[model samples]
Target chain A: MTNATQLPVTLGLRLLRGPAGAVLVMATIFVVATLAFFAINGREAVSLFQEMVMGAFGDSYSFSETLVKTAPILLTALAVALPARLGLISVGGEGQLYLGALFGTGAVLAAVDQPGWILMPLMLAGAMAGGALWGVIPGLLKTRLGVNETISTLLLNYVGILLVSFVVHGPWKNPNSLGWPATIEFPAGAIMPQFFDTRVHMGLVFGIVAAIILHILVTRSRWGLGLQVSRSNPRVGATAGISYERNVLIVMAVGGLLAGLAGIAEASVIQNRLQDGLASGYGMTGFLVAWLAGQHFLRIIPLSVLMGGLLASADSLQLYAQLPKASADILQALLFIIVLAVASLWGRRRDI
Target chain B: MEYFATELLTLLFAALRSATPVLAVVLGEAMTQRSGVINLGVEGQMLLGAMTGFAVASVTGDPWLGVMAACFAGIALSMVHAILVLGCGANQIASGVAVLILGGGLSAYYGTPFVGDKIDTLGNLNHTFVSDIPLLGQFLGPITPTVLITLLAIPAISIFLFRTRTGLRWRSTGESQDITRNLGHNPVHYQLAAIAFGGLMSGFAGAALAVDYTANWVEGMTAGRGLVAVGLVIVARWNPWYALPAALLFGASEALNLKLQSWGVNISPYLLATLPYMIPLSVLMLSYRGLRASGGGMPAGLSVVFQSAR
Candidate 1:
């Protein structure tokens, strides 16, 4: 893709545009957009923007909620960026996430009596396998069958979501819930370990560690160099003894594995039950973050945190101001648009 | 035997109703992709249309106004895609995804008030002459205005694409910018127009779903149909004519799912819902080679767009 050789451009953007200017642009645009949006809706719109910030980081408790949302987004962004490094646009992170939860929940149910040591490993493995399975299908389809990875992965998303819905609504419905579509509440041993008695769990650690390792592998390793070679010119890479097919499958599977981890983490730690609408738009959010960071792994970390804060703030806006919960989504989309437009314009001016 | 035929005819009619929104999007997508622009954000655009259409219709009590509003909403979003992709040289896929998120977010935000709201949906034309006929007549009975327009859209788009000079030039942009440039036309103009057209059709689709077919409002009601239309457009080999069959196929699956629910069958509603997606997927897999070799390959520019990261 034309975006792979964009590191130099990204670096130029960061340096030439200046960090302060960039933040100001984001803040000004966000303020105008959100204020206008609320004003059009006939809301008071006064000081709502400041409340949004406070909602995300007003106190220790609010900040912890932001971190909670950040974990899944961070992992999913890495999932997208990995395949993106291979010049493959895989939008299947949402599906992979649902598969992870489905598989992880299944493991927990099967071993309801098991202790933490046995259950955690088994459940994590199951979730990873499920996510990997989703990723590998699209990879194999592209590699062997010459299908468009983008379209296939997208179509799989609906199927994956429904697959979970089918089970919870049918075979997996907790009998005690009396027609409510959900699995039984996860046992205590099955839950992800939280830190500092806060809702923030080990998923955040997993995401940060994964991002660091991915950055090292993608930017500093020989295998990562092979991925670049294959991405730029597969035939040339093949001549250099790099199997493009192998790299494609490897990136896709690993990407799916990471997303699956996010899914199970949400189910076990957050929802405490496998249910419908589990992790609804996180994958899309992650995909946007991956692109905004220009597919740079480490950069994805801060963007995910910022996005998480924005999302957390939206919940507060909904409760306090009676704004629709989708307000955050609008702001997020607007931010990406402003960023893209500015970057592209800057590059165009340089070209001229 | 006669009674069974009636059931089959009713199912066929139900299929077309379900196909209305998806079919509209497919026609527009076929044009957009032919012009070398891809709009994967159709899902979000449709949702916006659905919400706007439902909201406006419920307030104004006119489904026609709802349809127009939805169309404008779609065109508005598509313009955003065009500006980002064509003007600023943003990545087409990424810009599209952003638009999708934006459209989804905007629609969900706006549609929040209209959830569970109802409207007197656009009704079907029940000509007594058509109704008086046999099983097929009843199948043809109750054809809604949106379905008629969409049915006509199939041939209208087909003619516009295969018969018009402008359509040929639009397809040329997808093939090569140089060729289009040499032909004494700016490819960007074609792409911009095509994207707008796609957006307009997507809007009509959302209106059809909200005001014409279902006559109600529901969040995310278009489901994956926007994406489905995108896939089917490829399956149709970028030809609007083939969308008719694909639409019906989609309609059939949807109709079956609905009927199964009414029938209280043993199958899970969720699994039944999967049938619509799964069928298209199977067709996608089975037809990939045969369809590719049949010579209506993907737009040349689209493959390049996906490969070049920018």
Candidate 2:
């Protein structure tokens, strides 16, 4: 099968049956089909390709936007990753993101006169606290009340969105900004300073650092082992004298905290004010990313950046290719379809 | 007392409308789940069915044809999920999510042209002969045809799931695939049939949303109603019969939100909108007792892969 003549079929089969096949096939199709379109349009395909490459990583300015895009995805991915380690599906990150951004921005606005150091940390903490509370409620419901975490968390996301929408459009609406449901800006000092002469802020640093810390926490710590045991089999972990309840709570809190911080990063660093679109679809996009990358913290960083780059390039695609803004979303969906189709073929020789 | 009566009556109709879609999908899902397969693509299937139903109905100016389109559209969507999850043996959750994404994006793309275009709605069944009859006729008269059809379907589905040979085999497969094989029934065929049933119901549900309810298509209009239906199934403990009241509870909440909003309530519409989700959350939380042991008669391999004997 590995011989020269059979290489294409073998590779195709392998691609269909492995983790990397979906992205590989999608990228191949995208490159070929898009280049074909460019050729038909009498355009220079190489220049079009170069424009995408440059838009993503042409210089420090573009690279920084990549990091900025990655920040929310990274934290939202953690929102899934942490719960997943305990066999829980925390799909509520979207809702958590909204709540975190809402309250975090609210805290900062309320403390507008305060100095940066105090207000920033306070707002960030508030965001984390809000998200953690939201996540924990579902965990508690699942553990104590026997509720399904998946539905609880999923519903919570909608609730959070509505709650945030109400507050932003009502109490938190900036009095000065005629009817736009937005929070007052944080004090200038409260904003994370730009990393260079770019809009990128320390939030990216927080994301990267959190990824490293999470890697250590999950791979090297006793808590990590306990979570692994619980995820593998809750019955066995309970028998091992490890508190499965505690594990669930811890995982939910960690997931929520990470997602909440992502909200803070967006509010204080990226958007600088809370509004209806603050969270966007970051939560849902992060779920796909986390699921695609096997939910590993370290792997999430690069994968998220890749997705972020694709999203960032959507602007360029719209301008150059006349694609709709939603085109990038379609591409992401295609990637997921291809990836899942490819990955599911592994170890299929045996029956369930 | 008068206020309470009016609220209750208003909620009754509202619950019927809201519950109609959930009931449609849950009945279909209940059948599939009984046959030892889980179709997590209910959400996507409903979305596809909804958009197709609306588009076909609006274009043809016929609600029934629109509904037929919904069923076919839903079945087409389910086939993809059935292929990936049942045929290729992919992870059900992952494949379901993929289908959901596909359904959302596909519908949005096609539905863009039809946005805000309202069609003649499916009219009420309030005939003077039936409607003039005392209280019972009055209650059933103003009801939509979709709700009447769904109410009729409940008993028919219950009979199909419990009183039939196929139903027994389906139950056996979900309970124990080994027993099913020994009994000489192919589980995959049963699963496929069950999923197709779910697709049809989802399509009907979607059609009801656009043709009967909204009279137009909107991007992501099904909202999380599909997920709510799944939750209702669990809340009903996979019983085809119990899904009625459970779906009705959710519907009533939504209807109340509409009624309140119309009456010029100063409260945020978002908060009122929260009731539908919150009620389900409360139900799931309250019903958590003794769920860990047997899962309220959930199929043993409801979401598991079944390997057939060669």
Candidate 3:
């Protein structure tokens, strides 16, 4: 009984000694600051907060919607989290996601008559391949050409989005859609299966499984240990015969695969086709989720759900509070800034 | 042949106009990078500046005042970046991305009110005395005051970088912070000053785009121009003088893209629109080997922030 009671106190003290304390403080500040903004605008702050909470988790429907949102965010967050382990800041997840959807749609369109089991896997493979190809470009550029991966990946995002726009507006426009720019909807066989009596699809299961597998692979496996070594000190890792270049390529591929999965899920399960809003800044939001989670695979699951709920509630802010949709964007950005500041402060204190 | 010549001249004028905003941003980022701090928040700063400038101009009926307001707004945001990156010793890349998001979100939120509002814009400089001259007059007649200022800024910044004593201190700080500190200079102060200047320039770029080029405000109007300017700094070998031609090259591509679209060409406008971004990527890739061999002209301490070693 003593051990059990003392365990929580010791664990809490340990968290305060590390990064968690700063994170908690920053989160508190973010909430207070947001409420202050609303108060300054002459709105009832308490009710607004209550409304947001209710909108996000008040009913089963909103909770289900939040879960639906979490699937894509989790995968995209993995895309950012994976490459971050390799010391590469790949902000091009948005581009890779678009390519994934494009390739998935193309695969489905090519084999419209195929059976469900065969077509689904093929679409997933094509999406992953497209994303991997996009992801590998930056990896290759960084390893071979000495170009900065950050800028190249970002520029490639614009290229990828433009490619999608071109195809949708030009060749892939559904002839019967009456001037709307979009591809033909996936056939019944091509669509993902949903849970009984809910909007949740197989993607949620995929995200959860991927998170668990990645957490184990990253924290418990030998390869994960090697990756940590290589990330922290490449020269030392190289001296120990670890191949730095191979890790870069492999890690980026895995990251792309995750993002690709998100893209295919959004296209086939949510929108049912590729369109202009297909990209939808999920990549950027995923990056935020990964950052908030401190790049921990296990942490990303819950953090993504929280972020997804916040985003879902942001839509209700428009209806209940009459705030603009961009209010959510502002909140997300503020949260990121505060977290960064707090983490930096924690880092500096540790140095002392 | 005559029609081609006229079209070419018009394209040149349009290119010069389009290049001014990029030049402003590239020159600002060039200076910031030269001080050993990479600020990736230029896009966000530009957006805020554009919105603030438009709002101020609409309210005050003074375009120059709007530009000044934009500059102040930029400095305010960059101050947040400076405090985070330099004061708190945060990761420059992450801090930059945060600033980018912060600037973008705030701009979008505030800009919602001014969406579709109009303001008096800066017009082109059509001096009769200048237009009286032959070929030179024709080249300069259609230029806006903002374009002329940007053109003048290239030579001015070049001289400041190469000939000024403070500029030497700034460059040395970027080369090696330890060396600069050993020489009794405060590297942090220099970096903060450089970043503030960057903010001012980015704000001016936004103002120029809003008041002179578009004469309107829109959400996310700066698009990726800020990132493009960051790339241009590398392509220009970190020299302010070289940034001129690089900016013009991008501007020219954008101008030609617009011209091609208007000419009823059969090519997809989306593909044509991609030429500006693709050109920079291809240029960076092709020049990689040369850049590596020549030591890439990057400052020695520029990437030191990424290293774990103090």
Best by lDDT: 1
Which is the better candidate, 2 or 3, if ranked by lDDT? Answer: 3
Candidate 1 residue pairs in backbone clash? A1-B307, A1-B308, A1-B309, A2-B308, A2-B309, A2-B310, A3-B309, A3-B310
lDDT of 2 by residue, B199-258 (tens): 889888888887887777888888788878877787777787888988887888898888
Model 3 residue runs over 4 Å out of place are A1-15, A239-241, B1-5, B305-310
Q: TM-score each candidate.
A: 0.95, 0.90, 0.95
* Candidate 2 lDDT over residue span A4-88, tens digit each: 8798888878776554555566578667655664566576777776776677777776777777787888888888987877767
Error of 2 at B94 (Å): 2.0
**What is the lDDT for A261 in model 2?**
79
The DockQ figures for the candidates are 0.62, 0.39, 0.55
Docking class of 3: medium
DockQ of 1: 0.62
Q: What are the chain B TM-scores of all models?
A: 0.94, 0.93, 0.95
For candidate 1, lDDT tens digit of each residue in A1-352? 5576898888876775764466567668767877887788787676777788899999998899999999999999988999999899999999999999999999999998999999999889989998999999999877776677788888898999999999999898999988999999998999999998999998999999999999999889999999999988898899999999999899999999999999999999999999999989999999989988889999999999989998888887788878777877888899888888877876676678
> Residue B178 deviation, candidate 1, in Å?
2.1
